[model samples]
Target: REKEEDGLETSPSKAECSVWEDLTLEKARLELNENPDTLHQDIQEVRDMVITRPDIGFLRTDDAFILRFLRARKFQHFEAFRLLAQYFEYRQQNLDMFKSFKATDPGIKQALKDGFPGGLANLDHYGRKILVLSPSIIDRYTLVDILRAILLSLEAMIEDPELQVNGFVLIIDWSNFTFKGWGLGSLAGSSGAEQDGPVGQMWLAGRNLPMSDVEALYANIPHKDVLQAVRNSIPDTITANLVAELCDFVLIHSYFRFGDNLYLQIGRTAMGTHMAPQYANIFMADLEQRFLSFCPLTPT
Candidate 1:
């Protein structure tokens, strides 16, 4: 059976058999809500959606490729379809990043050599792969190249079935990182108390939270919610309405320069802004307060 599946005339060795068995066991443990009996149907359903959507462009409709998105979204066909479209759309919009998206690409190779996203050989207790990043290296390379390196690493790692099922963790070391490196020199130059206020506290707290959590919070944050969070955090001497208006302006009209073109940021907060960190921290704190009030017994 293994020989047939693997397209080999000879039987797989003991090590290969053991690895397959381990992956099967790990899949069972992860329980991504994927029903083996219905998995083919699920994959077919998503593939069918992809076929009908001309806007997403020609995508790899192979079982393995579709299955990765399914597992990531717990086999929800619609959500997986949406993710598939976004995946292609992102690549389309950022042609430069994906142009030579390979480990050997000069820019990517340099970033990898600089340890932009260093990968660990060992897996976590959940059998998930771990990747580490050091922010201090950002100053040495363009952000696009760093992102390419990280994407290349993830693309290579995701080929493992166990990693697809269990996922991965990213560890970012902020040691020796400076505000200037993060494009926040203005904030760094502020008074000590201001520099160490909510933004500083959130930066410390963020180290403990999963990157996905932070991303999800910011991606789906309503403007009104952010305004309310800002309202609650500002000094009484400041006019709440005026601050709220300023916050709205920042959120609605945020833009950034990439290469020779300027791009407006949508969905999430603008990257590398002094106010961005504070807004995120304030909103996160508001969420925690709400959660605590709703569930008093839950540990902080």
Candidate 2:
């Protein structure tokens, strides 16, 4: 400890003193004061320049806390949170990107044509979708994951016949319209498909849901003819791939967004999407008829 403290005068060090040894303490103190005064004068000059110049920017460090304090005392109207959000977006370049898009994108230009034109409506649509999805509450990623998880659960059902989720089954009325073939089934687009396609039944959550129960549910549930409609949506060859993609998007959206949040709300009645609901029915049927266990895939 003594060896390490050799140069510390505060600790009674004995290191050799240099040039300052010949100067009086008063002279040294005076010189140090002079430098500090010079620094203060320089700072004042810049401060004065900033006050007079409109192009200069000033510190925001104390702005928020100060405003908040004033607000607490009920002095004038000040919305700190909104200001903070704007400030951060500006600082972080988020708002700048939005502005850039409005300035450069053709879509944005078309959207804003004249005095309060469709641009307002477009903004409304944006807000409407957010409100419908309630993304702020649930978020986009979680909704997508929910759909994936539902698929995993169904896969589990198929993989292990013994591992059923309460013996659930869904029934849909089918008159054995064996008239329908690969080209005739529901043409659910990307969102409706299950794993690679749609997979679900209406009553899969109920107790003692056997295949018979599923058939009963289908037989009992209200519906309409879909084959003719499906045929017209797309040609047979590409319909399969389209159906697969659409089905995936739909099932994932609904399964994931069982509840709504700004981050993840899909449009009303996920079934309304061209082929999502019907495809979902087919997917559920596949799950009950083919797969065994309905657990997520886990690494061994």
Residue range with the least summed lDDT across 10 consecutive positions in model 2: 125-134
lDDT of 1 by residue, 1-300 (tens): 246665755665789769866776557445777777877899999988976668767458889898889888977899998998888888878787799788889889999998778988766866778889998767666677888898888888888777888778989898998765643334324333333332333343222221224546566777889899888777773787789899888898888898999998866676576787788888888877787788846544
Superposed on all Cα atoms, the candidates' RMSDs to the truth, in angstroms, are 17.5, 29.4
Q: Which parts of model 1 have CA positions greater than 4 angstroms off?
A: 1-30, 186-300
Q: Evaluated with TM-score, which candidate comes out highest?
A: 1
TM-score between candidate 2 and the true structure: 0.17
**TM-score to native of every candidate shown:** 0.57, 0.17
CA deviation > 4 Å runs, candidate 2: 1-82, 85-87, 90-96, 99-105, 114-300
Q: At residue 93, what lDDT does model 2 achieve?
A: 52
Q: Write the per-residue lDDT of candidate 2 for residues 68-138, one digit (tens) a residue.
A: 32222222123323343344445455433333433234433332222111111111211111101111222
> Which lDDT values do the candidates have, in the order given?
0.75, 0.32
